[model samples]
Target chain A: MNHLLEVNNLEINFKTYGGEVKAVRDVSFHVDKGEVVAIVGESGSGKSVTVQSIMGLIPTPPGVIKGGSIKFQGKELLRASKREMRKVKGSKIGMIFQDPMTSLNPTMIVGKQIAEGLITHQKLSKQEAKKKAIEMIKQVGIPNPEERYNQFPHEFSGGMRQRVMIAIALACNPELLIADEPTTALDVTIQAQVLELMKKLQKDTQTAIILITHDLGVVAETAQRVMVMYGGIMVESATVFDLFENPKHPYTWGLLNSIPNLEGTEKKQLIPIEGSPPDLFSPPKGCPFAPRCKYAMDICLEEMPGDYQIDESHSARCWLNDSRAPKVEMPFTLEKEKTVTVGGESID
Target chain B: MTKNLVEVQSLKKYFKIKSDVTVKSVDDISFYIRKGETFGLVGESGSGKSTLGKTLVGIQAASDGDIIYNGQNIKQLNKEMKRNVNKEMQIIFQDPHASLNPRMRVGDIIAEGIDAYKLFSGKDRTNRIYELLERVGLSPQHAKRYPHEFSGGQRQRIGIARALAVEPKFIVADEPISALDVSIQAQVINLLEDLKVSEDLTYLFIAHDLGMVKHISDRIGVMYLGKMMELSNSDDMFTNPLHPYTQALLSAIPKTNPRDAKRERIVLAGDPPSPTNPPSGCRFRTRCPHAMEVCALQEPQWKEVEKEHWTACHLY
Candidate 1:
């Protein structure tokens, strides 16, 4: 399948007052046309930075994309000139940011914000954009679209503001959308509604999605393919089922175990991985996860592991998956993943 | 009943937007937390989950309710009584970064609560502070450092340590782990659990993350637009969600397992209605997937839908 957007060997760094922070390092992934791809990791795992780089939204004064290519529809976005890239930004690739409150202009009426994007990208007339903006408000399921059009961003709820943001992004009907933890700030029920709306819109627009979120549960629901990041490195990449059912990376296993599961609610105590992410200012010499990984080998501490192929589609960067190393038991959830399937279909 | 540690009865916290209209933030919601049990309050952003927690802890005075802690109404607490009660009922704020005093040393911040209750002398307080620091898995030496010195998880631990300094019998942990990294959230939660066991403390653990909240809470209360929509044991709430909202919330929780096909997701029509200008009666009626005319006009009476399981939806 031809990819709508492809990121190859992406590297990003932030010039902090203290020093340079290597936020994203040598990461690569692709989103097929109309496909929903999830970039999953804990905070500081460079998930957000990777997607932000794709849109050229990362500020250069501090955030600098040092290397790699971001190609959208075979167009080299990373190397594209400022004037040339501006044409593609909203018209071809729209972005819905993480926090709607901060993302939307506070003073401007929500409808006008949507209108501005359409006018800027498509050169829609004010009259045409106004009618189109109201139509968009309806499309995203906002109640009283006319009244809402006159109200500021603050007038809308957290979820509604997000909808308005989505409406703005989709008003131009961009071929691709980059949502960076779009619903993380929302409540669970509201998050569900927004996510459902996004998925539904994807069905209609067929816009390829780069959904960035740390929450594993959201990843499971939304993504067809999953890219797991740890300490600026893409540790694993696979289909959601393959990654969950047969996790090979020790970091991924730790992540699975750490999640508070409904099935395991009976257990009184939860097993928590001790320690923290290595400081980006000065990362460790080898595998970033080795310090906390229970299955960490001596070699893991000394050198980075090569990507180990689990299947044709699934690959994990872990020493434990090295055939030379001894095998380890799977996390309790993955053990269940071996059998569980949607629609009650048995898979082994 | 072994004398419930905290009893909230008919809690009606309504904000008077104007002379005529009122936003019912926590209307007629009631629950009790017994000694040494974790009771989780679960809901979305506008669900009044946080308001209910704040009311129980007296962070905000209830509009029309009784927060009876050990036979004393928290709303009626005098200056001295309020000061005394403050020790046994501390709140863990949602944003650890915003909650802590940036200018002051962390040691001073923790000790401020201790000094308020006057649990120990100057020397004893210093020693107690160090012990509390280590209890939350922070270095005792970190006491000298400012709030910015520690990571997000560590800063939250400082907040937890401050809450413990007063040696509170009950704590209202208001989304304590939401702002943390997934890698560090478990550690903080486990620390809270450990402290709960050691201190024999009751907790009103409020969060949007049902999965994380379920792990610690024995019984869970589901709130929506300032009302207790559903209340049940952790097992029952997950296994047999009564209210439509609860069912929707459960289905929404992203499970990592791939073979599990997404359930028929209850996509509520619109966002949660605003509290200030809430819909006529049943607040959830606007976005409720199974809403009816009766739901629009009449507020659903809270009742025991099943044995030990409570729900406030007409559909039940």
Candidate 2:
């Protein structure tokens, strides 16, 4: 596989008033060329911090990438000079955020935000940039992109503003696009629209996408491979089918159980994963999910299990995967799990 | 099956933009919540779910509507009667952090309703507040702390306690869990369910998450641009959604698969037209994938396709 981006032992820390807050710890994942990878986790699970570290968006005084290696197309990002980092930031890597209201300048027109990146990088003239901006917006499914070009962010609906955000991110035609919960705040219908737009754009442009979200439904629709994170650690990483159908990790099972499938015939009361996400302040001793995992063993609490490889492309961190550990299948909550596994295709 | 706890009839809220183009925030939307039942209203931002919420709670005046709480129109109530009706109707806002006052302690915030009604003594106030805190999964002692000290989930719990303080019969919960984490969203929802049953409460739960809405509601109402696009039993809505908007919405939810993430998606083209200058006929006609020439010129009548399953779409 041709990897577009790769990270190794990415450890990020924040210097707080009390002490150093370990945001991300020994996290590693790779995105392949033209592939869509989802980094799924709840808030404070280091999903955001890891990506911020990627774009060098985190404020260094309080936040620091203590130790890590970020390589994009075989070029080291952390080791790159300021000039080199600038070339890579918008030229090769694009990013869209959760809140478009904040991501976009309220005073500026939507077209300008998109054109800024193009003009800055491609050095296009005002007329050329405007034309491309409208085209990009139209491609993202924003209605009447030319008229909407002059409209401010507030003038657009939540779904439309998100579309604008996508247009701006793809303005420079980067190889990789990192969207942090692009649709979390949107309504289901609007969220669906944005997700569809993203998928279509990716198909048309063959742009690799890194989607970071807590919603498992999003993971199922938009990711080719998923990296399930908890407490700054990758709990599981596998192909979408492999992860959902033959889910190895107990945490993944917990997530699967928690997903409220609207399309299904049964309205099974979601057996939510008990307990809160592990606190980042005083980090847990071993596996962060051990407290919430239904199949936690003595080894899980005392010593975190090493990687258990399912296949060349699939891996998980859980003691239950060990051959010596007890074999216990966690009960699934889906009504028609047998029939609904394979054709559990896209809802939209 | 039972007498309605809250009745909304032709509820319309319109604002006069400086240009005389009326921005219909809630345009002729009507629904009723039965006693002790949860009526879930689902919609996108600008779909006016929150506007309907505020109108029902009497926080925002309805331009043309009758909000009959109990047996009286709240708008027509006398000053004293209005106060009494207001006391029985409470709302839990989307952002709990902003909804709650920072300076006030949690106990006082919760007890404000109790205090307003002059129902509890100073000595009993603490106990009542304590009871509410514990009921919402917070420690009784946490009442002494400020809102800022609580996490997003905990803050929402505090907000719930505050609403339940007066023992309101009907609660308008507007996107209460949308701001919380997914894992915690379920917890808060479960807590709300428990509270509704234990207290014999009627709830108007408004949210954008169809799954969560279906999980807790007896009936779900799908809204688009201030109109009730579809209304049906929770089970039926998911099983056989009739409205084009509803079907598209149901389909649009990103499936939880990582491998097929980049598949061909049906993204609706264009932004929703401005409400002030809404397109003729159907509000959703401009963005409807199945929209027709008739759709642009004439609005569809809201009719029942099956027993108790009502949808507003030309095709339906």
Q: What is each predicted model's overall lDDT from 0 to 1? A: 0.84, 0.84
**Weakest lDDT window of 10 consecutive positions for candidate 1 chain A:** A339-348
What are the per-residue Cα lDDT tens digits for candidate 2 across A52-170? Answer: 88888889889988898999999899888888889888878999999988988999988898999999899999999999999998888776778999999988888888888888889
DockQ of each: 0.66, 0.54
Q: Give the alpha carbon lDDT tens digit for every residue of B6-59 in model 1.
A: 888998887787999887888887778777789999887767888888877778
User: How do the residues B77-137 of candidate 2 rate in per-residue lDDT, one tens digit apiece?
Assistant: 7899899899899999889879999999999999999988998987788889888888998
Model 1 lDDT tens row, A179-226: 988998887767878988999999999998888998888888889999
Clashes in model 1: which pairs? Answer: A217-B254, A341-B259, A342-B259, A342-B261
